[model samples]
Every structure is written in structure tokens, then in C-alpha cells.
Target: MTERTAAALRVVNAPWLRPLIFLLLIVVMWDLTIRIFKIPPYQIPAPKDVVITLWQEGPMLLREAWPTTVATIWGFLLSAAFGIPIAMMIAGSRTIESYVYPLLVFSQSIPKIAIAPLFVVWFGFGMLPKVLSAFLLGFFPVVVSAVQGFKSVEPDMMDLARSMEANRWQIFRMVSLPHAMPSIFAGLKVSITLAVVGAVVGEFVGSNYGIGFVLQRSIGNFELPTMFAALVVLALIGVVLFWILDVIERLAIPWHASQRQDVFLAA
Candidate 1:
């Protein structure tokens, strides 16, 4: 490769650099749009304006950002904590699967946004509602993916384990669980994004703090730049959280076929 091509290849290989380039492209496009269209600041503020607004309101945003992040994390953890056991039960037993499968499908069919008001009424404007909302939004993917992963275990491998006289738990731990890692990670990525939405929905219903609360307030006040700044912060937090999980997946499942595929594609 030429020197410039080699440098571009190195950047594409580096995960952090890729995001930095993305952000730069976004800002450049944003600036160009504003300049070309003479877009009013109230409609779509320039990146520099949003940056200055962020600087001015850094402390406020940070304070609000914490509660949203906390709620999102707790809700995500709850989903994983509850989802895995239920998924395991369904995966392991036909009776359990038959009993809960319809209910699970029905739950997902409902419009979660429409139910936000009822959640507020029932839970009464607190962290509980927010966390529960987040959990509800994020939990199904985990359960569904987990079940699929467990079910996807190769019959040949299961037969081999049986022939070796492996116990049920051993079969699960050595065969099913490892095979399920990629699906679990996939579910987690979806869950984290949903978790952020859940938190914001909860805030929209009722909240004194959180990025969602600030965002709502900004919208009401016509503070477009500040609104954009809050959104940028929310996006950054989500990206960071997702990146951390991606790193963990890489470290934990380095030998998985999916990981190998990702490496091959990257190459």
C-alpha cells in the first residue's frame, strides 16, 4: 500500500479513530448545511454553537446526565438479571416454553410508548417507573436471544456430550452457553439502545433531572443549541456504553465464530 493508503488502513483498524472521524464528518456536514442554507440557529444550530452551549451548561448537563446514566445502567442490569433465568428455563424445558411463549409475544406486541402514562400513574413519578420502563424495553431482546442461542446448539455436540456422560449443567456450561455468547452480545447491543429510550420516556412522563428532562425543557424554551448539546451528550454516553460492551465481548469470546468473522471482515 502507498503511505497514505497505509495510514488510512491503520485508522480504519483503530476503533477509537473511526469514531473520531465520524464525529468530524458530522460536524463538517452540519457546519456546511447551516452555512449553505442560512438555517436559523433556532432550527438547527451549528456545531460550534452547540459546543459553546455545552461548555456554558456543562455542569448542569453533567448533573442531569448522571441520573439518566444510572437509571439506564440499573435497568439494563435488571433485564439481564431477570431475562437470563427465564430464558434458561424456557431453553431447558418444553413445558416452560409452552407456558410463557405466548405471554412473551403478547407483551412485546403492545405499544410501550402509549403505556408511558399508565406507568406514571402506577409508579408515580420516581426512579422506579423509569427503571421499570427501561427494563421492560430492554428485557425481551435478552430473553429471546438467549433462548435462540441455547436452542441453536448443535445436535452433534450435544450427542457427543451425552456419549461422554456429561451432566446437564456441564452440557449447558461447556456447549450451550459458549455457543450463545454471540447472540447474547447481539441482544445486549439492542438492549442498551432501548434502555436509553426507556429512561428518556420515563423522564418525559415525569422527572426533575436527567438528560431527557433537560432535553424536554430545552425544547419548551426553544433553546435549540442547548437541546442539540444535550442530545450530543446522550449520544456520546450511549456510544461509550456500547463500546465498553463490545470490548468485553471481544475479551470474553475471542474464540467464537462470530468474532472470527468480525476480524475477517475488518481485514
Candidate 2:
């Protein structure tokens, strides 16, 4: 390649630039496909139409989005609060692991969508149901990853801590917790995104608020542009929440090998 062309290719391939470039390419291809095939707007709105709808209805969308955002955050926080302790208990004892782990797995096997209506019925279409749904979806990942992290702690390190006269709490706080942070953060990141999905699922089942409701309404009315716009909002919510967890992970575990690799890439 020519020197200037090679420089442009390297810039586009950069870690930070790659996603935006890919998104732009997708949008371009979408617009081209629509034009070439003469697709009906009602069947599939053009990208520009979706963008226009998003801009025109931005305020209303944001207002509806607030409830979903709140539900997602609350649900994720609840998952982390309960999941970590449960994981620790399970990791600390074989009996607890044998009994609780199976139950946890069984709970996940039940489809969230199948039971979502029950939450609405029991909780009365309130934020509680949404929060509960999010909790249910986000909880398993945290517990599983945390259990793995805690169990992965080296026996040698524990022996060293005991040799130094460190108590259980001190050893856990200083050694186990630090070693498990990367895995915990990985689970948190997954949980946060799933929480967003759970929140939307809750809204889909029963709420009168949130982007989910907007999507349902747009679908019923066959407002394809509005439907696409709501979908875009949902995608943005998931992306932003995931990105926040990633930032927090990097900050919280700067010494982690993964984070060190990220630093190397950025440099």
C-alpha cells in the first residue's frame, strides 16, 4: 500500500477507532441495501429515518428511558450485594456448594420470560417486578464467577497467611479478594448488561413506562421508524452500561493482567 493509505488503515484499525468504523460501515451498507432493493419504509425504515425519528422524539424517549435505567441499576446492585456473599459461603464449604449450586443452576434453567408475567402479577406492574426480574437475570453470573475466583485462590498463599498468624478475615481481605477481583469484575460486567435485558423484559411484560413500552407501542402501530429508534435506544443503554463497568473494572483492578494488556494496547 502507499504510505498515506497504510497510515489511514492503521488509524482505522486502532482499538478505539475500530468499533465506530464498523458501525459506520454497517449503516452505509444498510442504507445501500434499502435503496437497491426499494424496501418499504413500513417494513424496514432507512437509517436516516430512524435517526430522524430519534432526534425528533429524543426528549420523550429519554423520559421513558429513565425508569428502565433506574430499574437496571437497582437490579444489578442487588445481584452484586447478594451474589458475592453467597459465592463466598459456597466457596468456603463443600456442603453449601453441593446444595446451593444445584438450586442456582435450576433457577437459571427456568426461562425468565416464562415467569416474568408472574412477577408483574405478584408485584402489580410496579418497579419492584422490574427490579426483581433484573436481579434474577443478573444474579447467577456474579455468583458463578465469584465462586470460581474464590476457589482459584492458591493454597500456598493461604498457608503463608496462616503462617504469618493472619486470621480468616485478614487473609480473605488481603489475598483472596485481590486475586479474585478480575473474575469478579468480569462477572459484574456481564451482570450489568444482562440486568439491562432483564429490565426491558420486565417492561415488555407489564409496565406502562420505559423504552420497552415505547417499542411495544411502536410495533402495534406499525411505526417502523419509531420502533427502530427505540431499538437504538436500547442498544445504547446496554452499550453505555457495559462501558461504565469496563471503566470501573480498569480503575479498580489496574494491576490485573487484562488491564495491563489494555494499557499496552492504548500506549
Best-performing candidate as measured by TM-score: 2
Q: What is the C-alpha RMSD of each candidate to the true structure, in Å?
A: 2.4, 2.4
In order, candidate lDDTs are: 0.88, 0.92
Candidate 2 has a TM-score of 0.92
Q: What residue runs in model 2 are displaced by over 4 Å at the alpha carbon?
A: 1-14, 261-263
Score every model by TM-score.
0.91, 0.92
- State in Å the error of residue 17, model 1: 1.2
Clashing pairs in 1: none
> Candidate 2: worst 10 consecutive residues by lDDT?
258-267
True-structure lDDT of candidate 1: 0.88
